[model samples]
Target: MNRIDVHHHVIPPFYRDALAGAGITAAGGRALPDWTAEAALEMMDLLRTATAIMSVSTPGTSFLNDTSAAVELAQRLNDFTAELRAVHGDRFGYFATLPMPDATAAAREAARVLDNGTADGVVLLANSNSEYLGTGGQGELWRALDERGAVAFVHPAELPAPEVEGVPPFAADFLLDTTRAAYLLVRNGIVRQYPDIKFILSHAGGFVPYASHRMAIAIAADTGRSILDILDDFRSFYFDTALSSSLAALPSLLAFAEPSHILFGSDWPFAPVVANQYFANGLDTGVDAANLAAINHTNAQVLFPRLAGAPITTSAERPVVRLRHTTQRAVARALFKLVQPGTN
Candidate 1:
């Protein structure tokens, strides 16, 4: 029953203020939810997530022209999450955000955060400019992560292009970004060079499950090596059971990945239908309960050994505190009002 979530989102006060003059339809416009520390803890209870490792959800300062501002906000967000870990006394952990689109600034933040032992890992967007994750010299960021065999949770973000009228930001654009980033790593050899870093792919490895056949053929045509042969790079990589844990995806994932390489992800308020979606579709009964604990918390201990461990147990060793919203956290309800982006 030791459950932990490796993928969750938080809106820092900095980015919230930056969106003021920006119209709802700016480049790959993002919607704001009434996200607050209190509401997040409550959602944790409903989702049965004992501890959530939060990260910089999309718009990780990739759009901002001011690189310094991006760096400042990134540090502040890290500080805030670390404070949450401090306040909640180990119910949460976080991935550090870096100001992408600027290699030097990003390198500085990653080095500082990880070296200080503040972050569990880093959450990198698929692209910061027109360049994808492995392109634009972004490999340096991964190299820094590699030095420590750290976790790299690759979450999808909207492409910085004008919207294609019918396609909502949440549609194909996000999926495409995830695919492009993963493909870029393979092509650019970043995944090959930095084999030490553990990369966690979001949204059930994006569309890679369905598209791998075509990609495999393309690679076979060029390199004479099967794409699945190359997928071994991802052997060290991890997959989070986010919204894609539903029927359409779980089967493919089961067929593709060993369960130990799989982890839990809620995608939280944005993908609220996740848990029920899996429930309605049914989960793979073969999944290991102990491994489920690993997906939830144990493996994270492997990732961040310094992070707080198992919750306090009762006389029967049962987790008496489970996921209830403590009275102290409920006081945060004053600010956690629901808003747009349609509830998750």
Candidate 2:
């Protein structure tokens, strides 16, 4: 399969050095992996990935306390990735990095890159300095992205909470972190208000596919909106299969997400080549021919139409058969009990 990997990551030399300078050597509880354009292409070839849309992973520019310095670093990283894409147009696309928790600066950077065609989209940390996405004061950035109808890849950062003694943030907290951001986006009306900005949730949307209804019910209860409407908004976000193609996860994801909203993802160096292969194999064998083709590349072609060589089958073009709300509610109740055993 010539897969288009949407969750690929890139680590520029300057960014790595800055982390070291700040005494921050790891992200999401793992050491930074070595990355080069050549090495990335080599891995892509090994994984049978035709193209990889790259982004900087967690802790993005958030490590820099000085907003000005963070803004400068973001510009440099974006320029570096943009040049890489310029050189390897056939193999690579990139999401521009931005200085966050600084919405004004982020909005400016987003416009600069998107207007110039230098970025496929932008990658946002699930939170920056404990300020989660969809929080107040981010309207400037959201408006800029919405105006462009941009693709925003929401990758998880390290959780704001203290870590458990033996658990790595990436192992579990990352999922919760992504889930929190997704929940806020829907609950705070960011999804509804900025409908044009396509949001791609990484790590198969963390716990989203499994807990969506539970979250939807909460949102409905709090806001007095219909649970069905909230659930529909949850489904509107896109999801990527990166380290999340296990038999258990893939099935729930496939059942919960619209067929066209699921895209292929390989976390590359961060996930190790062997792990990437493991998940890819799972996906390949899990689905039938047509569905496999769509998950691997066809579905992504709709989001990035320039990549499509033939006729495209868009989400709108595909038949959408939603699960009945009553059934989803029943399953949600069961899952809620499973995850929250003591709850009423």
* lDDT per residue (tens digit) for residues 234-300 in model 2: 9999999998987789999999999999999988879875567567767876889999999989999
lDDT of each: 0.68, 0.88
TM-score computed on alpha carbons, candidate 2: 0.89
TM accuracy, model 1: 0.82
lDDT by residue (tens digit), candidate 1, 1-344: 44567878876665667655443222233356567777787666655667788987777777678898789878888898888877876667898888987877887888898898778888888877666787756666777888977788888777768779877666578878887888777655677788877888887678766666665566567776656666665444577777665445777876776567777777765654334233312333334557556666666667666644667321223222322234323422321222132433
lDDT of 1: 0.68
Cα RMSD of predicted structure 2: 9.2
lDDT of 2: 0.88
Q: Which candidate has the top score in lDDT? A: 2
Each candidate's TM vs. the true structure? Answer: 0.82, 0.89
